[model samples]
Target: MTTGPGAGTTVELVKLTKAYGATVAVNAIDLRIAAGSYCCLLGPSGCGKTSTLRMIAGHEDVSTGDLLIGDRVVNDEPPAARGTAMMFQSYALFPHLDCVDNVAFSLKMKGVPVEERRRKAREMLDLVDMGKYAARLPAQLSGGQQQRVALARALITRPGVLLLDEPLSALDPFLRDRMREELKRLHRELGITFIHVTHSQTEAMALADLVVVMNQGRIEQAGPPRELFNRPHTAFVARFIGGHNVIRSADGLRAVRADRVQLGGGDLRTDGTVRALEYHGTSVHLSLDVAGADDFAVIVDEARFYDAPLAIGAPVQIGWNHADAHPLAS
Candidate 1:
C-alpha cells in the first residue's frame, strides 16, 4: 500500500471527554497508542468504546482535552483530514457498485483519473485477496468477502491509524477466527497503527498487542492481554475478562483464575456443590454454589474431568495456591 502523510503516527488522547447534555459517554480519559501497534478498545455495550473511537476518527467532536496524531492536535479536523479510516460494523459498501468501484469510491470523490483510481483499487483488492471477486456486487459476496472489501476500502486511503468498529461482529464464529488472522496479517504488512473496538474478550486477547478495558465511561485497565488477564486491577476487569472468580476474602476481594483451582488440592480449600458443568472440548467449566461466592467456577482438563467426572449437585472441594490470588482495587 501507499504510506501517506501521518503513516505510522502515534495517537495520544489527553483528558479526552465526550458528553451529551447530562450523559457523559467518555469521561476524561488519557491514553497513548504507539505507532504501528494493534490496540483494542474493549468493553461491553454503553461503555464508551465506540464513542472514543469515533472521536479519534474525527466523526465525533471531542468535548475536552486534546487528540494528537503524531504531535498534531487534530481535534478540529474533519473525518477525511484526521489521517484515520473507519471500517463500520455493517460493512457499508454501496450496493449499486461492484467491489472494485466500492473500494475506489473515495478516490473517485477526490477527482482522481478513472484508470489510475481503478488500478490502485485493484491493488488494494489484491492486498485483501478480494481481487478475484472485483466484479461482484455486495449481494453476490458472502459476509466475510464483503468485510474484506470494506477493509480494502478503508485501507485505500493509506490511513496512519485504521479504526475498526466491531468489524468482525457480523461474521460467524469460524469466519471471525479466520478474519482475526487476516486482520493481524494486514496490520503487520501495512506497518500502521490499528485501533479496534470490540466487546469480545477473546477477540481482543487474540488480536490486540494492547488491550484497553473500559467500564462505565472509564478505563478499568490498559495493558498487554496477558497482564490484564493475570493481574486485573479491578473486580469488573477480573470478571469481564472471564475465567476469574472474584471472592470476598478475610482481607479484601481477590481474583483467582478458574484454571488454577484444583478439585481437592492446594493451600486454600473450600467445600461447594457443583451447580453446573459446561463441556468445552478441551476443558470442562464447573460452576459451584459456594456459601459466600455465588459465581464460583473452575476449569478442569478434559482428561482429568472424564477420569473422575464430578456430576452436578455433587459436593466437592475446590482450592488454589495462595499466590494465585490477585488482589482487586474494588
Candidate 2:
C-alpha cells in the first residue's frame, strides 16, 4: 500500500547462511529490517556485513535459508527483479556518459524510450540536487558530485530498499559528512529502507535508526544506536563501539561510558595512573592504566582539564555513579 520509493518494503532474513566450500561467511543469521527504516550493518573487515548486503541485493546467492522482501521470498530473484538497488562504495558512474544518461541507463535496459527515460533520470537528478549538471560527464564532477549521480541512478528505479556499501568511505572528511547528511535527507524524503554497511561507528551512529554489529560472521548486537551505546550487553559490543571502558568490578565485568567517569570523587572509585592524554577541541581523553584492567579511559571537559592538567604518570582516582554502570557478559 506504500507508494514511490517509500513503498518501504521489509527485508527479513531467516536463518540466513552463506558458505563457500569449507568456509562459512554468514552463519545462520536472522534479522528483520522494518519497513522504511534506516539500518546500518557495522563491523570490521571479514565480519560478513558486505556479504549480507550483497545477498540482500541479489548480487550474492544465499547459501541457505529464506530471504524475504515484504511477504514474498526473493532468494531466487535476480538483482533487478528484486525491489532493491545498491550504490557501491566506488560510485561506479560511467565515465563516458553524461549525468542524466548514466542515471537513465537502467531504464534504457528495461526498453524504455530515450526521451521518457531521460526525463525520469533528470527528475531523479533533481531529487538529489544534481539536475543542473545533467549534461556533465562523470569526469567533470567531483567525487561527491559523482556519488550524487550514482545515488540518482539507484533511486530512479524507485526501489523499496536501497543498499549502500560504504558509500562515503572514499570521500574526504568534509564531503563525507556532507554526503552523509544528504543521504539522511533522501531517506527521509523517500521513506524507503536503507541498509548501509560501514566499518566506521561514527557513520552508523549518525545515520542509522538501527545498528547491527557483527564479528567473525556473527551478529554481536543489534539495536538502536543509543541503546547499544548506552547499554552494551557484552564486552565486545562495548569495546568495538568505542567511548566505553570495560572494567571488572565486584559484581563482575561491566561497561561504563568514558564521559560518565568522574575523575575525582563519587560513590564508586578506582585508582589508576594517567598513561596517555589526548586533547580534542571540545574535550580531553585521559587513558588510565589500571593495575587489574585493560586501558580505561575518562573524558573531561577541555576547560576543566586545562584549568588543572593531570600530568602523565600521575596517579588519579576515577569514580562514577553505580547507575551509570551496565553489566556485560563474559
Candidate 3:
C-alpha cells in the first residue's frame, strides 16, 4: 500500500544471477516486466544495471538464470535469435549511409528487398518524425537526430523487445526532454516492450511504466516512477532521486518530498534553522539545519511559499503527516 505503481506489464526474471569468477554482477533476482511496458533499470555506474540489460538483450551470457520474454525462457538464445533490438549508447549509425539506409540496414540483412526495406525505413523514420531528414547523412544531422535514426533503425525490425542503453544520455537537456516525449508517444503507437537502462533519475522518472532500482548487483526496488519518487523504499533511492530530506527517528522513517513539503509552516514548532536557499525560477531548494536531526533539505514551489515562513537563519517548524513516512529496505 505504501509503495507500488499500478502493475502494467508481465516481465519476469527467475533466479537470474550473472557472475564472473569472484565477482557477481547480478545476484539471484526475480522480476517481471509486463508486455508493452516501458521499464527502466536505474542504478549508479557498475551496479549491474547495464549487466542486467545486456543479459536481457542476450548480449551478455547469463551465468545462471532464466530470462523470460513474455512467457518463453530465452536463456541460451543469441542476440539475433531473440526478437529484440538494442540501441546502444553510441548511435552506431553508418556514417556513409543516409538516415533511411541506416534505419533499414537490419532489414537488408533479413533479406528484404531494397524497395521494401526503404519503404519500411521511411515509415519508421516518420514514426520518429525524422522522415524529412531521411536524405541526410549522420554528419548532417544533430546528436538528437542521429539518436532518432538509431531508434528508427531499431524499430524497423519490428522487434518485440527494445533494449535501449543510455540512448538519450548523449543529448542536451532540451533535446532529452523532447526525446522523452517522442519515446512516450512512440511506445504507445508501437505497443512493444521497451526496456531502458540509465542512471539519471530524471530520465527514469519522466519515462517509465516500471522503474527497477538496482545497486551492488541487486535490485533495490521495482515499480512506477511516481511510486519510486513519492515513496522510495530506502535512503539510497531518496538520496539518488534528489530533492529529498531523509531523516531517521524513533517514530519511523521520514523523507520530505521537495514538491510536497511546506516551508516554515509552523514557526518555532519544529527545530530547523534555514541555512541556505537556492531560487530556481519557480521553485526553491531549502537547506535546513535541524538539531538532533540530519540536514533536512526540502524543495518548495515559489508560488506556494507566499504563505511560508522562510528566512535565512530563522528557526522554523517542519512538519509532515505520519502517513507519508513509510518503511524502506534498510
Q: Which candidate, 1 or 2, would have the higher lDDT against the true structure?
A: 1
The models' CA-based lDDT, in order, is 0.94, 0.92, 0.82
Candidate 1: where is the Cα deviation over 4 Å? 1-7
Candidate 2 residue-wise lDDT, 1-330, digit = tens: 224845789999999999989889999999999999999999999999999999999999999999999888999999988889999889889888999999999999989999999999998899889999999999999999999999999988889999999999999999999999999999999999999999999999999999999988889999999999998988988999999989887789989899999988777888999999998989999999987678898999999888878999999999988898889988
- lDDT for 75 in candidate 1 is 97
Candidate order by TM-score, highest to lowest? 1, 2, 3
Of 2 and 3, the candidate ahead on TM-score is: 2
For candidate 3, lDDT tens digit of each residue in 88-154?
Answer: 8988899999999999898888799999999989988998889999999999999999999999898
Give one digit per residue, the lDDT tens place, for model 1 in 1-330: 346633587999999999999899999999999999999999999999999999999989999989998889999999888788999999889999999999999999999999999999999999999999999999999999999999999999988899999999999999999999999998888888999999999999999999999998999999999999999999999999999999999989999999999999999999999999999999999999998786998999999999999998999998999999999997
Model 3 lDDT on a 0 to 1 scale: 0.82
Question: What's the CA error at residue 181 for candidate 2, in Å?
Answer: 0.6
Candidate 2, residue 186: Cα displacement in angstroms equals 0.3
For each candidate in turn, the TM-score is 0.97, 0.96, 0.89
C-alpha RMSD by candidate, in order: 1.6, 1.5, 4.9
Report the CA-based lDDT of candidate 1 relative to the real structure: 0.94
Against the true structure, candidate 1 reaches a TM-score of 0.97
